[model samples]
Target: MAKKTARIKTDTHAVRLQTRDDVETAIKQIGDLQRQLEGLAIEQNNELAAITEKFAPKITALKAEIEPVQQAVQAWCESRRDELTQNGKTKTGSFNTGEVQWRQRPPSVGIRGVDSVLESLRTLGLTRFIRVKEEPNKEAMLNEPEIAGTVAGVTIKTGIEDFVIMPFEQEV
Candidate 1:
């Protein structure tokens, strides 16, 4: 009876670097490819910038023309807002071209001198207005890992290894 040999599975598409020289060659190739990619990116950006520069003046001129017209339309709308919106029954005025809307933004609070306000709130016994945030102190946990690791919910990971390949390149 002949013994059957076990066959190991291998990825067909994977690059196999058999020796130190192969790895070095791969790294050099990577560096060359990176330089080529960067050059292409720079060329693409230059072309895009030239295109933008060519269009910018026309865009600016159009915008300059539109601004005063838009202001005039807004002024007209504001002057006859009640009639346009049918005496506050609707917030939008629908014309043949498009609709203009009067939108009320949600109220917002702006605070200046936050420290002084917080101190005043504290002195006035207005603790309800003050916010107290509570969270796990990871730095303290790292400082005392033995105690931290004993906690049921927390798992302290150690000796994590990562493989990295950095191709050599010259700085411009």
Candidate 2:
């Protein structure tokens, strides 16, 4: 029987050039860097989206909140300015009718010409001074020059040379 010959092996330098370890190391480093970049990108995107969401609605809501207030303030300012800047508008029809009717006031009357000094008192406001005694010139009550006007249907007379001011008392 012939004996089987063993095959001879050669350590070729070229065949050993590309080792599995070097290839594995390079692949591992590349994979790690890729994973880190993906993580950083996801984190950045999340942060930016959150920041945008936080302020975007707030800006609109602030305008919505302030719009009515701004309009109201503007309206108030315009009204006040118009009121302060009043132009003279001559109101018709109700002239002198109720202009002096708002509140009770003292009455007075004035006179123009007369013969006697007491009879020249054309205007008189006070009815109380009607029956009062005269000063300096002592004269009879019925002999004075009668300046006549009425108060509450009661006829009053005075001889003063100036306006007679009535007491500021009236019925409601």
Who wins the lDDT comparison?
A: 1
Q: Can you write out model 2's per-residue Cα lDDT over 5-108, one digit (the tens) per residue? A: 22223333333327878756655555556556656999999999999999999999999999998688657645554343343232211224321112336997
- Residue 115 Cα positional deviation in candidate 1, in Å, after optimal superposition: 5.0
Candidate 1 lDDT over residue span 1-172, tens digit each: 4333223233344557899899899777766777778789999999999999999999999999999999999999999999999999999999999989999999998999999999999999998999999999998999999999999999888766544455666454
**Please, what is the whole-model Cα lDDT of each candidate in the order they appear?**
0.84, 0.49
| Lowest summed lDDT window (length 10), candidate 2 | 163-172
Name the lDDT value of residue 88 in candidate 2: 23
| TM-score, predicted candidate 2 vs. hidden true structure | 0.27
Cα deviation at 33, candidate 1, in Å, is 1.5
Q: What TM-score, computed on C-alpha atoms, does each candidate reach? A: 0.71, 0.27
